[model samples]
Target: MIRTVLSLIPAEYARLTPRFLAAVVAQAICQAIAYVLLVPVLKSLFGDDQAAAWAWVAPMLVAVVGVLVLGYLQSLLGLRIGVGMQADLQTRLGDQLNTLPLGWFEGRSAAALSHVVVDDVREVQGLVAYLLAKVIAGVVVPLGVAVGMLFVDWRIAVTMFVAAPVLFAVNSIAGRLYSWSDRRIHDAAVESDTRVVEFAQAQPVLRAFGAVGARNRALDAALTGQRSAIVRMVFTAVPSLFVFTILVQAAFLVLAYVAVERVTHGPLSAAAAVALVAVGSRFIEPLTQAAQLGTTLRSGAAAVDRIAGLLAEPALPESTTPVNPGAATVGFDTVSFGYETGKPVLEDISFTVPAGTTTAIVGPSGSGKSTLLRLVARYHDVTRGRIEVGGADVREQPTVTLLGQLALVSQQVYLFNRSVIENIRVGRPDATDEEVRRAAAAARVDEIAERLPDGWDTVVGEGGASLSGGERQRISIARALLKDAPVVLLDEATSALDPHSEAVVVRGVHQLSRGKTVLVVAHRLATIAHADQILFLDGGRILERGTHDELLTAGGRYADFWNERSRAAGWRLEPAPVG
Candidate 1:
């Protein structure tokens, strides 16, 4: 357990560990020496030697003072190292998050990550700042006392050594019990946190459908489970602690019994026997403390294990020698991918978008249209083949170099709670105010801002909740326009908008896509009739490919799809015939 925790400490903080431990050791020795001095002082005083007793008293006082000073230094070091370690751990976790593939985030809840970063890390911080020092003293103090007793009385020293293993066995049993309970408690807490966050975020939908009561049942169950786990832990802990404490007292009594038996036998004086009994009492004090600290040490170990596991998660591999893209062309060579093994979402797909041209992916639902676009963006590496961006394999290019060449505007737009203009500036932080406004005007975002209470300065609520779907899409398009990348990828950006808003956003899309390498996932066939090339996909493979006129003339799946959509467009509701 000690080695596992030390492995996670950053090098800078690990360097102070030796100094911190030395102080704890030195303090434990002083405390043992002070207890040993009791034997000599009491024996001398009872023997009627005032000068010898005073001489022993002076050094005992010095040992006590040493203990006090060393303890102060130990605490100071622990706090300094603990605080530094907490910050470094959090920073490392953040860096790890940045390097991970986007798909990794898809499988985890935000609440689970939050609990690891906020709650588990805080527990580790408590370990070093407070619990570690006490736990160390509990160990070293008792061992020091046993060694010191050898010179004072060999019989008592032998008794303590004999009692050591028995005490350790009992303490170990208690620690194992507590560790089991702590793990369950931690799991329950994580579930409770996840349910609470889900409940809070889904309030609008829950209330709208009158399913709030249904959701409340899940939350209540989570809370109840957490409460039950905590109660079980407490019940299990008290009995173990009580058993360990009783065993410690029993060991002390055995030591006392030995001293009394020796006094009645030959060669041991009454005064020295009395002093030996006094020393025996001091020996049990640290032993009891160690048993009490068993739970704390186990808790710290559990927290460290959680932190190490997260840090050990693999990050996406990068090229040793990254290549820079030379053009804005995107090519897929027999690409195949899936979120899980043996469940391919795209299979044997091949397509290319020449520089300064547009390719529209048109398909039914679940046809891997958006997944194909994401492959070009390299959300996850291809499972079977290669994806090329700008004439170079995306895997061989630096992430920054690849992302810098393309701008993505998906249907689900997320905006931080900040001013309207500030959100647009996210595209290019170095862009001037005039440049931001220019893109906003091209996307018609200026029209939406004019009605906001604070105009361009108004804070768009979290996830742009204050804005309508069409309004958010306009801001997203404005962001893409500000980026001005050589290639643009749109994932059905205007599919859910009203006709008026669709027209407004389409004009912005045209401005953003003009003279760029474009890959668009089109839901409405009419929108992409003029695309340079169209791939009609179904069941994870492209079944038809050509220009709209060519596909219509061929009378394949694409032609049938177009005819169906054209007929749906002309349908209208009519009153039923009178009965």
Candidate 2:
């Protein structure tokens, strides 16, 4: 545990660690000295040596003062290191998250990460600020006193040495048990938190389906699991604590018995034996603290393990000498990918989009349409082949340079809780207000602003809940327009809009894609009928590749898909006769 904490401290604060530990050890030594002096002081006073008793008291007072001063310094250093360590851990986590592949952030994974950053970091911070100091003192003071006892009475010292190891072994076993329980409870808590967030976010759908309240089985199950885990933790903790406490008491009893037996056997005087018995509590006190602190230290160790695990997650390898792309073309050579091994999502897929040309991919649900666009953007590296943008392998190019070369408008749009104009400016942070307004006008976001209560300055709620779906899409389109990169990737950008809104958004998309390398995932076949090239994808492979007219004439899978969609387009509901 000590090694884990020292490894986590930031470089700037590393020098303070040795100083802090020295202070802790000094304080523990002084404490043991003051306690040991009690035995000699009592023995002298009982023997009627007033001068010798007073002599011992003087140095004992000084030792007590030393304990106080060193303790103060240790606390100051611990606090400084704790605060710095917390901030550094948070920063490191942020940096790691930035380098991780985007596909790793699934819902449960995100929730668990959030818990680690907030709760686990705080727990580990407490380890340095409080528990670490206590732990050092607990061990150091006890060992120092046992050695001190050797000078006063070897039999008592030997008894303490024998009991110390037994007590330590018991505490070690109990600590492991508590740590295991802590990790289980931590996982269950994260799972419960994920379910609660899901329940809240999905309220609209749940209510529409009449599955709200008691009918929401996922939420109920999650909460039940959390309760069960906590109950198990309590059950595990109580027995471990009970056994540890019993062992601590037994050790104290054995030490007291040895001191009394020494006086009976004529190896020690009554005054010395009584003093030994009195001073024995001081020896056992540190051990008792160890027993009491065991659970807390185990919990902190669990938190530290979580932090270490997150920091240990592998980041995508970045190129040492990054290269720049030479063109705006995109190509995939026999690409294959899967979220998990032995289960491929895209297999042996190959395609190329020439510079300044438009290619549309149409496929059934789960046919890897969206996955194709994600791969081009390098959201995840290819499993078997290479993806190139502008004739440069994406893996060889710096992430910033690769992302800067293209504009993406995915189906799932996320907007910050900021003013409408502010959200639109995210595409180009340094863009002038005039430039932002111009892009908004092109995307028809101006119409949305006009309807909002505060026009362009209106604060959109979280995820743009304040605006309609079509309004959010318009704002998204405005962002892409402002970016004005050489390449564009649209993942069904207009799928959520009405016909009128869709037409307006399409016009904005056309304006944005003019003279750019465009690759689109199109669900509406009619919308992509005029695309320069079309690829009919299904089951992770392209079954047909040609112009829309050529695919229709071939009378294959694309022809059948197009005919079915055309028939569905003209279908209408008829009024039924009254019963």
Candidate 3:
């Protein structure tokens, strides 16, 4: 565990480790000196050796002061190392997260991410602060005490050697029991955290179903499991701890018997016998502490494993021969993709989205329309064929260059916890305030922000909860407009809004996509009537392709879908029984 943790730290901090180790050793020696001097102090007070008592008092005072100074320095150094290591882990973890593929985030909740970023690192930080100190003291203090006792009487030291194996066996048993309970407890805690986040986010849906105060069975079960694990751990470990305490006491009993025998009838003086008894108590203290250190080190070891596992997750492969091509036309050359093997969501697809033209994709639910657009964006790379952006194979170009050439505006708009202007500015961090306002005006974002109490300066809550659905869509459009990339991808940009908001948002979308290579996953047929070309998709394949009116004239799947949506759009909620 010591070697594992030390390897994670920066090499510059290597000097501090030995410094703290030395200080802890010095502290153990000082404690022994203080305990040994107590014998002379006691003897002089009781007998006629007044000068001897005064002589021992000076050395005892010096030992006491030395221990206090060493302890202070040990803590200061540990704290410095812990704080530096925590920040370094955060930096390393952040860089690793960026390189991971978006598919890696699937099925991982906000709670799990928070656990890695916060809790796991914190456990290692605590190991540096307190557990490392205990471990060093456990090793150094006992050895120091045993070495001194051997010189006085080798028989008394032999008792400690016998007790060592017994102490280790009992501690090993207790550690195994605690470890089993702790694993269950940790799993339960992670499940409970995930449920809490889900329940809070589902508050609006739960209220609609009249289940606001109702129990969530998954969450309740996880909490109960955590409580049971804690109770079991206590019951199993407490008695075992008492057993360990008795084993340590047995060693002390043997030392007491020998010290008495030497003082009464053999080769020991009264003061020397008293000194062994006093220092013997100090020897037993570290043995008891060593038994508990095993569990503490095991916890730090588990946390280290979790952190190391995440760092080892593979990054998306980068191109050795990176390219920068000229045109913004996108081509899908027999591309295929799937989240899992043997179940391809998109297969053998081929098409072109030309520069400065709108190509809309129309399909029913589960037709892979959205997955098609995601491929061009490289959320996950093609499983079989290659994708082209700016006329170069996306795999051949650097990821940054591919990202720089396109802008995505989807229905799910995520904003930071910052002022309204700042969320819109995420599109181009270096854009001037005036340029931001220009994009906002074009995308109709300024209208929403100006209506708020603080106008452009109003703070949007996490995930843009402070803004309405239409407002967030407009904000996302403004970001795309500000970016001014050559290619634009839209996923049902106005699918979730009312007719009034849809019309206004559609106008904003037009402003953003004008004179750019545009690909849209069209949900409402009416929105794509004037598209330059329309591809009707079903079951991962394009069934028909032509202009909107051209597909309608053919009386195929596109025509049937168009007629159904057109009729549904005209339906109204009114009193039918009045006639």
The TM-scores of all predictions, comma-separated, are 0.90, 0.95, 0.84
- For residue 503, what is the lDDT in candidate 1? 91
Show the lowest summed lDDT stretch of 10 residues, model 1: 209-218
Judged by TM-score, which candidate is best? 2
- Please, what is the whole-model Cα lDDT of each candidate in the order they appear? 0.87, 0.88, 0.81
Q: Model 1, residue 351: displacement in angstroms?
A: 2.0
| lDDT digits (tens) for residues 507-545 of candidate 1 | 999899999999999866656797999999998999999
Prediction 3 global C-alpha lDDT: 0.81
**Segments of candidate 1 deviating more than 4 angstroms:** 45-51, 213-215, 235-238, 264-278, 320-322, 553-579
> Which rank order by TM-score, best down to worst?
2, 1, 3
Candidate 2 or 1, higher TM-score: 2
What count of clashes does model 2 give? 0
lDDT per residue for candidate 2 within 476-522, as digits (tens), equals 99999999999999897665678998888888888899999999997
Candidate 3 or 1, higher TM-score: 1
